[model samples]
Target: MTATIDRAHAAARRGPVARAYRFELVKLVSQWRIRLLALACWIAPALFVAAVSRQSTLPVDTLFGRWMHATGWAGSLVMLGFAGTWALPLLMSLVAGDVFAAEDRLGTWRHLLVAVRSPRRIFAAKTLASLTVILLLVAGLAVSSAAGGILAVGNQPLVGLDGHLLAAPDAAGRVLLAWVCVLAPTLALAGIGLLGSVALVRSPMGLLLPVLLALALQLAQMLPLPVAVRLALPGYTFIAWTGLFTSPAQPGPLLIGIAVSVVWAATATALAYLLFLRRDFTNPAHDGPGRRAVTLGVLPLAALVAATVAVVAAAGATGPGIEQDKVQRSVATAFSHLYRLQTAQLNRPDVTEAQLAATAACNKGGGRLDARGPGNDWRCVVTWHLPGIEAAGTAVYQLDITPDGRFMADGDGPKEVNGYFLVRTPTGDAPNPLWQFDGNVALLPAAPKG
Candidate 1:
């Protein structure tokens, strides 16, 4: 059709301003994929919250506590870092990959341009459609994840990075804010995928290439690149999100992360539009050797894979080198060695799940102290009280784990010989150890939950 040819010719000519809007609208349907992705997103966080909420090990409740336990209660933090850092970028890729590239996949670009009557308008539509849906899908996933988390875990007090527990209101607010901050970095990821889509119109690999590129970037971050490299990654948003855990929570990294992602996204999208316009689909030579030399050409795949291996190796090699430290050692395989049941302790009247529930009412007010001893030994000062003990002075106890698996306690002001572990007993009673004290060495052993 004369009309169809004209439209194709126009998408090539649309100025930068128009292309932005064009890309955004065409993929409003990304929401369908989002709806599906939502199922997995919602279910995963909820299940984590539920599993954590039901656990008897953590001294209290929290999202990170659940995350920590999932990290095998602090013992597996290094392993978690190695594996999960890639997750955000991978997720962002699913949506970004389909944006501009999907038009090519469906063979709609030429047809739609004809219908639009203006190349500029088509570009605007596509860009707008892509960005809008990407933002919404991410927002929806965040909200759903938070909602499921709140409902599953209950808005209980949250423990902080310093092991300081926060009241419910602040805890709830922080979690939601952290989820929102994630949006900026995620958009950066979407931007990368969008650029790939726009550039690779003729190939099915367009959908997959952006993801491969992101992984490559993640890998490069680990190599001995200049300092600038660390500051520039679009997906570095995930790392910046770590602010949610730091004391006084720094926004500097998060804001910088947004700036980098946005700038790169804008630049990449502009380049894609220029390149796509210069080539005519009808021209066989466009995909020929000359254009081939412009990119890593056929080698983005090899580059991406090599980067993957490098990063995995780099992260493993560069950790804090604390493997031999006692804090890094497992006291007993957690949960595997269940605390030897004391039927006498269980039969005691106050030690019931109901009494343990009383702990929920225990007003959480405590100061933090970081203390260390002779054996690669670090002490976490928990100034806490067992509920039901009002006259009891605030005790700053030294939570010491020896160079081996042994834990020791030296604290001020308590006739209690050890800290109390409020536990559930199968023999009908769960101790309301709200104020009871126990030795610091008590670690129940069990394999991490599946």
Candidate 2:
């Protein structure tokens, strides 16, 4: 009886933030939608892996799709790309966007703010609760996708974007790291959802706004925007994990992407908090955003646009573009490593990358003299010395380069020379290491003019 009384006193002494947080968590736990979303997060990826595993034709369009049947690691990566573009933002919005809007819909905002008598505490509690759910969902998706991939296809060595093969253990580590990297951008989207939740009182509007914005941002990213402009947006970071799989992992863009994402999340969440404070909770008839909502929203959005414009203007002077030399160097190095792997698979005498001495001359826009910048028109001719052969072997490649510093190299060489889409190896017919590859080009300042 004494111990029970002491526990009661302890619960009574809990601070308002803690109490509110507990309340929000309990409410979320009681919701069927939240429960269903959590279940989907865990089960959907597994089902996706199973479905992909049964396909006779691989999704060659996706970065890791060609290897989906060869290794479970590739299956996880293929899912990662798909989730980034579609599932993740929608999932985040469904929860964070509804957290506040639900209270409005249920007419509980007056009680939460007036009866509780602390809007700030309530806001803090709701934000914390929503973020907890979001983080858990993301982590669940990552773990489920990885586990499902391993179960469906087996954890074989993964092929890196830079054409080097990663051991199963190393690939596992990189896959985890890649998932971790995506969390920043995902949180940024959550912040956008939170803003929508507070600013748009209607549940449907709050839930759909962030998803719509994400779609728009993705479309904008695909355009030939300035490098700075593209990098400033959080959407670009969704695919930034590609750099982690490169031969010399390009941490430059990863760090920048994380920093950019943090800034976006901070600013957007702050604006959401400010708007939440200004909301007139006593008015039950407030169906749409009021004058203050429009004012507060416009100010932050305008500032963001101004900052982006300033960055774009500053970057314009440098004439930033994907360098031909960098592309040539990166693709050539990656090709040598892949070639060595292909030879090893065929039981040929082991050859070293140094021995091959590969070199590539790449041109953009169909042999234009000034062959620089990101585009799908880039072409490269690679020449390499083969062991015991007098003439250097040659391969032609076409590159589709994205503005955010990734490129897909498709071998245009004769199938007999470059090998077909699938190559016969001791293990079976695995993906040809030469038919297609991926690589990164670091966005560095161009060389100073002589």
Candidate 3:
């Protein structure tokens, strides 16, 4: 009899929590709000893909935007970048923020706990349900976007950041990988919404707080903060997937993004769990005074702002810009690569880096100013051979360096070599070839003297 009683008690304990989780899932699915949101997630990408399919020009400012009209895969990646800006956060918050606060709004928390006999169980159930909804939403968006892209644009070879063409199958795999990469930061946003839901106990505050926080962090990135600080923000992680679309696939940024996202999500979820444990759901009046709640909220935000200011102040205002020698070397090397790509497009014989015998001399601002800093007045005189034209020419490049050592150079030279360059296509037609020295290029370090 004792053994039978113990078995019955164990079954009883398991039954309620399982039932509560099921109830939460059912409740979420049954709601029109969630249903509509999920439907929108599925439909929005299709509409965006269709609308942008007709555009003649590519949005090169955004990652993968340059190739959107070229392939359905690129279209999906472009949308992913757009979504990460705000849509991901907003969509995640919509459900996560409401999971707990909705009960408070309905005045059903007491009943919910009483029925389950454990707030812990209810919290777990609701959290699990919210997570399940998020997973479904993410999957829905990924599938719809990928399908829409494939159907509307068709798969084509993608141009990588390094100016190499990625085969269609390889590009498709990377695009899907990029979508998966975004989920890490999306979960962090969900955690923030969950924290707001439990801590604020108001649906509006829960929904808007996370979104506002994300926006604030994004704005903070625009300030002259240290790279480390900027990298720590969840918003920075959103673009880390761009590295995946590059040649040889740089995974460093993606790894850092995942690490930072994990930290933020873990911190927020832990804080939410602790706060939820201490709350008294029996009496709504026991939820504490408004002023005290406001103080608690403001304190953290103020601390963050102060810390940012202090770090910026300590780091000082200057960054090590590109050195003159570096600029000269980079300009020569880049010109070689650019010319090589151009010649290859015309079915010319392979031009060796040695064959060009490229050389460059750089000057800053037409005067003796510091070339080791970012400025628009830098110039480089580059001389290289054009094997196809069987001639050599000197090009004067007007260069600008970014704080991060990126260089953009525009040159006045032979129109054939300067204004437009081509990439070899399988279809034997050059469509919208890249321009040399017309876009951002990384400065190459000076070769070590033997």
Best by lDDT, which number? 2
What is the number of residue pairs that collide in model 2? 0
Give the per-residue lDDT digits (tens) of candidate 2, residues 398-437. 9988876678888898685464777887888866878888
By how many angstroms RMSD does model 3 differ from the true structure? Answer: 5.2
Evaluated at residue 281, the lDDT of candidate 3 is: 75
**Could you arrange the candidates by lDDT from highest to lowest?**
2, 3, 1
lDDT of 3 at 47: 80
RMSD of each: 13.0, 4.1, 5.2
**Per-candidate local distance difference test:** 0.45, 0.82, 0.70
Candidate 3, 377-432: lDDT as tens digits: 88888887755666767777777665434455665555555644344456565643
- Give RMSD (Å) of candidate 1 vs. truth: 13.0
Best by TM-score: 2
Clashing pairs in 2: none
Order of the predicted models by TM-score, top scorer first: 2, 3, 1
Q: Could you give candidate 1's per-residue lDDT for residues 1-450 as a string of tens digits?
A: 999999988777665446446545534554576567656554554455445545766533212433333222221112123223554565656666665555555666666666665555555566676666556555554555455445654545544442334566776566556666666655655655655666665465666665676676667655544323454456555545545543445455456566765655665666555555555655433332245324623344335434543543343322211122223222211110111122234543333322222111111122222322223234332222334755422333343333212333333324332234434455553443222221212111222478
Name the lDDT value of residue 401 in candidate 2: 87
* Cα lDDT over the full model 1: 0.45
